[model samples]
Target chain A: MSEILERIWEYRQISRVELVELTGLTSGTITNLTHDLIQLGILRENEAISGNVGRRRVMLGFDPRFYRIIGLDIGRTSFEIIVMDLNGTILQSIEREMNGVQGPEAYFQVITPTLTTVKQEIEAAGEKILGLGVGIPGPIHYESGSLLAPPNFPGWKGYPLKQMLEQQFDLVTLIEDDARTSAMAERWYGLGKSVQNLVSITMGTGIGGGVVTNGKIVRGTNGLCGQVGHMTIVLDGKMCDCGNRGCWETVGSIPGILSRWSQGSTLMELQTAIRQGEPEALRCIDETLAYLEAALVNVQNLYDPELILLGGRLFPLLAEHLDQLKPRLQSRLYAFAKDRLRIEPATFGTSQSAVGAAALMLGFLLSEPVRLLSLQDS
Target chain B: MSEILERIWEYRQISRVELVELTGLTSGTITNLTHDLIQLGILRENEAISGNVGRRRVMLGFDPRFYRIIGLDIGRTSFEIIVMDLNGTILQSIEREMNGVQGPEAYFQVITPTLTTVKQEIEAAGEKILGLGVGIPGPIHYESGSLLAPPNFPGWKGYPLKQMLEQQFDLVTLIEDDARTSAMAERWYGLGKSVQNLVSITMGTGIGGGVVTNGKIVRGTNGLCGQVGHMTIVLDGKMCDCGNRGCWETVGSIPGILSRWSQGSTLMELQTAIRQGEPEALRCIDETLAYLEAALVNVQNLYDPELILLGGRLFPLLAEHLDQLKPRLQSRLYAFAKDRLRIEPATFGTSQSAVGAAALMLGFLLSEPVRLLSLQDS
Candidate 1:
């Protein structure tokens, strides 16, 4: 049944005959499964507008109006709440900025009212709320869905965010690291669909990474496998917030680059200066690029991923320099890895983490529809 | 049948009752499978050495006399061949040193005769040769089992080593990178038996790493993952043979360390000097440890394996300093990973790679007994 749903999701609108062919299910089994799915409001049938006029076959697709997901992205500086459909279409989104220092209580005070408003709107529209997925900016204890010491946001350490959200909203909830959530977004809805092994590097104010191997996120023993930012690039280099010296984050992060450019130069001003080929700006960008290149080479060597998806605020600024990066990496890579590893900009701008949080819920729903049904029944 | 064999391999010897209890297979099924396995000379039944005075149940165990594997380890400086049983016992072993510049043909000249002598001995003892497992030092095209461009050994580039051995010996042969093969040996017979995720770092003439995740080797796209030696530790510090600057291998490897010390000083002399607390030797050792610590921290951050098995020649030299490495790594690691990761020396001494190579074939047989049966039938 999940396979049938996955086929429909892939094709968007596939006929019953095509489903039978693609899934290798008997026509009777397909009919029975489709009927059950339609009853659950998980799938809908529409009349196909075919070129041939013999008969208009019924095509199956997701019933977007029946259920919606609440995706919350709690970033370092701000938090966002978005209502998303199964098709990843955003129904509503709201962003609220906070000072760098805020405790869990203050965060909940802002989040509870916003969540209630979204829940009410969802109920008023006659759409069932599937779940809430929160994307936080640090390591998470996957089983408990609690935050592990997030840098700068020390107040949220060990907070039972998943349990709190589940109890307050009375919905199924999942908490994942923001980088991993972004990876999920890319895997399901963006360029990652074509590849099984991918690494998503999110470079914003701080650097974070998500590793995907064999089409699933690699959550290591403590769910801290993709902490590429802390990887050392320089011997006895700059001290980082993590208490490490010469972390990739020290040189490759947005703030790190800006700080090196000038004391108060904006990213735009630096970009302008780089475009004009100013020596100091070029020198700063070159240093950052060198560090980025080394880190990228290290990533390629360590993971040997087929595709590396670059996302977050810093990637767009570096996208233009990627051509230069390729040749440099090719020289540094293992012989077999040369020319095979691809570096590309990730799809989805600004709302990547929010959509990814929604994707986390959607992925769970698609893979285990019975769980969703059980939750609804309960 | 594989499950039963694996259980027997685990316990060394087990009664039908124990097998049934352990595997959840019915008594009748266990009896039938054991009977068939005995007929095929894969298992042998023996009178139980029982402490309890009841009906003395018979025990089943592997028939070590029936089959053996030819394990060949081809390294940059030398080559070793070993005859290993299903229990990983070294029945026979041989080693030969080579000039570093020896090509594939020259090395094969030495290996073929030694392999033939071992095969003759096994046949004389009425044992069947199961297969050949070769551990080569370089990136390999996994499917074809051919060498990729190995550093310093340019003549071995693109050598079809596996096919050549298969054609020469007329035995089912498997080729794998040396570090990965060492990991296989660890996973099956060493400390890695307790942990599903492991990384084996072989630091000898050069540095290489093998990653095991979820009890399986992570052979990334092109089968070129776990190249940790090439990961940059210093930004533009030293030029490596791989054309990369500041590679971990350039500093952490045996030659890398020796070169940093007095050029004429042997590793033994340096070890002696460090023991005497000479200032220059202490500085060199400290520098080496610092690089090693940084690389290890990077490894822990990247792979996050529960156990990191340190192998190769250089490890024993630095084993005493591991006490110092722990606090340094703890201070550098992400909060969750601190104190959770275990660093231990690998079990196998000089014969590590050879035993690992044989274990590769043993692993294949244990997982897929049908493939071995078909080979015998053919």
Candidate 2:
């Protein structure tokens, strides 16, 4: 049954005959499964495909109006919300600053009404809400939907964000770590579409990573798998807030880069200075690239992914210099790895987190369609 | 069918009634499958279980003498070979020094005759030869049984090792990386017996690593997944033969530790001096531990494995210092990781690579029992 659905999803507007060929399912089983899925409002028949023949053929596709997902990205300094269709197309999206939001209660106060407005707008558009997916920074208790203590966000420790949102919106909710969510977004709708093994990294205030292997995202034992920023790049070099010394983020992150240059320059200023070939800024950026090279080689040796997708605040600046960085990065790796490792800019850009959050929901639905059926009962 | 074989393998001895209950198979199905397996010589019926009352029961178990596997480990300076039964018990074994042997032809000349002698001895003992499993150091094209260019061995690039052995021995050959082979050894019978996710590190002349997730070893995109030793620990600390600066092995490995001193002292001398509290040796060991701490922390953040198994030449020395090293290692990690990470010495010691090579064959047999049927035809 999932084979048929996946075939339809892949082809977008595939006919029954094409789905049968693609899925290698008997025509009768395809007919039966498609009928049942259509009845459940999961799939819909499209307008007739008019061929130069006696009878026109009807196509099948995801019923965009049937189910909607709200993807929420809660990060260190900002939050984003996006309403998307079953096919992962964004219906609406909004980003807001989280500068003054302090505690869980304060965050709830800001998000609850905004969520309510988004829900009303989605309902007004006549799409049934399937679920909400929230992507948070730091370690997450994925099974319990509880955000663990992230050093950057002190107050979010053990918070039942999933329970609160599920109760408030009265919809099933899926919560994931931001890095893993971003990786999923890439796997579903961006550069990682056809690749099975890859690492998606976001280099912003801090570096983070997620791994996808054998076509599934690995969340690790405690959902702490993608903490690439905390990986030690320097041995006893500098103190880190996490109580580590010489972490990759200490030298490669935005604040880490700025700290070398009087500490008050914004990312914009640094980018401009580097573009204008300022020596001081160039030196700092070069040092950061050196650290980046080490971190990337470390990841390359560890995961050996087909591609490494780079995103977040530093992506645009680094993307422009990727050609220069690639060779240097490749040189640091073992000979066998140099032949296969590829580093590229993330395709989704600023929209990655939101799309990734949404992808979390879609991934869940697609991975376990039986769970989707169970959710439909509620 | 694999579930039944796995149950028999796990229990070692079990009655038909117990097998039915354990596997949830119908009693008739259990009887039929066991009968078929026994007829195929894969299973054997043991002596009856004595009972005070009622009819006695015959126990089913693996036929230890039914098949045998040759486990071979080819490292940088030495090689180990062992013939083992289905239960992973070594029947015969040999260890030989590489002694400046270089290139594929030289290594093959030494191994081919040694393998023939081992085969004759096993045949004299009346055991059926199942396959040969070769564990070599460096990047292996696992599917093709080819070894790529390893820095330590310059001449053996793109060598079709698997084809040579398969045709020579006239048996199916399973070739794998040495580090990954040792990791397989750990997963099957060592510290990682119960832990599904683990990173196995071998700190010897150089460093190496292997990752096991969800009870299966991860070979990565190019079979170079666990090159943890080459990860840069110092930004520009030392130049390495692999064309990298400050690789972990540059400062953390056995040779690296000895180089810090007079350069000719052996590992045993360093351990003796450190144990006797010699100041210079203690300093060298401390410096080595610092590098180890950084490397382990980096791996912990990346894989988030439940266990970190330390193996190779430094295993005994480091295992002795684990008590002193644990706290320092934990301090380097994020708080969340600190709570869950465990570092343990690999249990198999010197025999790990050989046993792991054997496990590679057993693992393949167990993972896909249907494949065993195809092998029977050949």
Candidate 3:
């Protein structure tokens, strides 16, 4: 039932024949399933448009007033929260700069105001909140509900995100790596909807990626997958905090870009120069994409996501340079990957992580749990 | 009907209550469904086993006499054939070496003799063959039904794989990369049955990987997934024929080991020395593992499959050194992955690819036709 409903939601709206064609389900099965779904308050009969005089067949769609999931984007400097309805509709969202974060406790200390406002807004609108999802920039012990320290975020180690979210509301909570959440946002509501496999490359002060395989996030063993920034894309390039050298992040991070700017000029100067089509600045960013290409090739050689999305605050600049950058990537990858790979700029921009976190909560509710007797003992 | 039968086969045997409990379906639903499944001739009620003596119950099992799939393991110098029943039970299998594979016509010459022998063997056993599946060592153009220029098997590029098979038998024919096929085989009858996401790493003449993400094989846009061998692991360590320097295969493949050994001594001499506990030869293999460690880190950071299966003809040596090698991987990867990641040897040994190809064919027939359109197109 949920699978059929999901197909409808994914397609936004679907005709009866198309549903059978897409899902490979019998027409009778589709009819029976959709009937039950509509009666359950999950779906509605979407009215036909008044375009041409033809057989006016009504389409099926999710009711916009259905359950909503909360999306949380927790970063070192700030946080953003969003409420997304089940039909991919946004209800209420808030973004704010963080308070003084000293230790892991302060991580929760700051979100109190944002959380209160979001819940109040939803309740005022007379809607039931399904769940809260928090996206953090770190390696989470998916089993233990603990966050490990990520090099990019200095003081966010060991944050009890799941407990705090669950305590705040009588709802199931899910926590995901911020970059993965960003990737998910791209996949669920952005350009990734059409792709079965995609790599969402998030380039901020640090570099990260999320793997979408068969239209699902490729969470690795222990739930730490798609950390492409940490891969050794450059050989002996620079010393990275992750105890490795030539990491893509080491060569192509915000700090690395700023430092290079400082060596001769400044980012502002480079920005101004690039605005006027400066050859040197274009060369530098193009070179950065070369490392980006290597990391992406390593990613391609592994899972082979059909699309590659470039996200983060740097996207505006990255977009301008992509026209120049893509050709380099084309020449570097294998013949098969080069021919099939599609590169696109991120659609959600800075808010992807927040939106993706909410999707995780919804996904958690829909997922079937696995039982590990030994793990339960532990 | 088949889904319920699959559940019965998976559990080996289960009571009505157990089925209800496992499936979370209502008792009435289970009873009705079981009756329908039983009527379908896909399931059977075998003799009962009384665990509690007085509380003996009928044991339901998959009907072993339903149908079968034929699998072919197309290798560089040999071929392995396997006949698997619909319920993933291998009825008969055989392996034979090709004396001479001169050119692209090798498939026509070598395959004829092997198929004739395999047909007689299965006919003698009185079984119904459903389809034929073949696992190629390199890329195959599923649409063209021709082999790609595989690096290892130089003589068999563009061979008409599907047309020849279809001529001899009235059976479904499926084709796949050997690693991908081997990964599917594990998903059906081996270690991957319990895991949703997995990476099967085959370390032999070359290092290859098969990605199982979201409980399905991740065939890339061009069906060239799991090409971990081509990924560069070291910085200019050794040149690869694919025009890349220091590919994972360059440092971790058997030919790579031989190349490194040739610089000091022959691989035979090194193996003999290892048997005699010679320090220098031991150090060389240890260095090879170090290079492998880099590739392992590369694999982990990219997708993070739950379990990493080490397979192929030469993986027995890897098993002996896993205890030592696993620690290096642990120390390098993120804390959560280090504990959650499992490394195991291939269960099917030398015949995994053959078994996997057969499994692919069987799964296609058992599943809804629409899902396997790409497979059917070949």
Candidate that would win on lDDT: 1
lDDT (Cα atoms) of all candidates against the true structure: 0.85, 0.83, 0.73
lDDT of 1 by residue, A133-250 (tens): 8899878887887888887676889998888888888988888999888888888878777788888889988888888888778877777788898899988888887767889988
Where model 2 places Cα greater than 4 Å from the true spot, the runs are A3-27, A45-60, B7-31, B45-60
What lDDT tens digits, residue by residue, belong to model 2 across residues B290-371? Answer: 8888888888888989999888977787877778889988877767668788887777787788888888888877777678
lDDT of 2 by residue, A215-326 (tens): 7899788877768898888777789877788888888888888998763478888888888888888898888887888788788877889989999988877777788888
**Candidate 2 or 3, higher DockQ?**
2
Prediction-by-prediction clash tally: 0, 0, 3
TM-score of 3: 0.84
- How do these models rank on DockQ, best leading? 2, 1, 3
* lDDT by residue for model 1 (B1-378), tens: 889988887888899999999999999999998998888878898887687666676999988778888889999888899887777788888989886648988887788888888888888988888999888887888877899887867589999998898788888898999989899889887887778889998998889889998878887886768888989998887888776789999998988898888724678888888898888888888999999989988888788899988889898788989998889878888766787889888888767788889988888888888777788757
Instruction: Score chain B of each candidate by TM-score.
Output: 0.94, 0.91, 0.86
Candidate 2 chain B worst ten-residue window by lDDT: B47-56
Cand. 1 Cα-lDDT: 0.85
Where does model 1 exceed 4 Å of error?
A1-38, A43-65, A99-101, A263-265, A276-279, A366-372, B1-39, B43-63, B263-265
- In candidate 1, which residue pairs clash? none
Clashes of 3: 3
